[model samples]
Target: MYAVIRVRGRTGIKKNIADNLNMLNLTRISHATVIPETPSYDGMLQKGKDYITWGEISEDTLKELISVRGRLPGDKRVTDEYVKENTDYDSVDALATAIFNQETTMKDAGLKPIFRLNPPRKGYEGTKKPYTEGGSLGYRSENINELIEKMI
Candidate 1:
């Protein structure tokens, strides 16, 4: 799965970019959502790259995210038993492994589409440039999980 995060605030954003962000469910700054790596998602990410950062997430990070942010239909937190009862997985780690393997998505496991992350504890370098230049926008590859950890 891929993790798409809103790096910049919403203001003066073009209509198309805004639309893509809305579709991705990243409607607020510091918000994130896990998405499957499909062609449609790739296009949306590309179109909104200037305002967001995305990349593959690690199993460890995925587990923490699910434990801390995963919510049920009625806005209840997911427990191990809930995961076992609702999905095929016996535990969160098993579910997380499947997500990393692209065998399942957050939606499949009953997670909320959006993750309201805390701003990175130490703050981001900046949000204007690409990740290659030490800014927060654009893709960060597997390192995206590291950034997510700081925010979590």
Candidate 2:
């Protein structure tokens, strides 16, 4: 079963959850990660507004790079999707370990904050939108619905 423990304001993990989860022999909920896309990152990496290609760097690569550039490394589609789909398991594991662990929390000002432990099952249908790397995940932004719908 997916075990859950409600917490607030306690951002960093302590030994308690780790030890408990260890005894339970189940995965604990992941720490938060900030999403990495912005008009700036796009401007830095993207060639143009249209469907332009950057040799050896396809749309998926650019997106992964953007995701990497943006900071949603924990989610595979955002990070590992750039790697060939059929890439070896070890390679994927290495990438996951190296990249996913580097998480960030975006706290947008327009949306009200409502953090959660998991990715939304049906996009914005879940409790809160995902965080961005150093960027607010629309936390207190008035664009909560749009942020949740598009970014979560």
Question: Which prediction has the highest TM-score against the true structure?
Answer: 1
Question: Top lDDT: which candidate number?
Answer: 1
- TM-score (all chains, Cα) for each model: 0.91, 0.17
lDDT of each: 0.88, 0.29
Model 2 residue runs over 4 Å out of place are: 1-6, 9-76, 79-81, 84-91, 100-116, 119-152
- Superposed Cα deviation of residue 67, candidate 2 (Å): 14
Positional deviation of 88 in candidate 2, in angstroms? 13
Candidate 2, which ten residues in sequence have the lowest lDDT sum?
A: 48-57
* lDDT, candidate 2, at 122: 42
In candidate 2, what are the lDDT values of residues 38-137, reduced to their tens digit? 5553342222211111111122322233333333335333334533343332333344333333331222211111223343344332223223332222
In candidate 1, which residue pairs get closer than 3 Å at backbone N, Cα or C atoms, i.e. clash? Answer: none
TM-score of 1: 0.91
TM accuracy, model 2? 0.17
Worst 10 residues of 1 by lDDT: 104-113
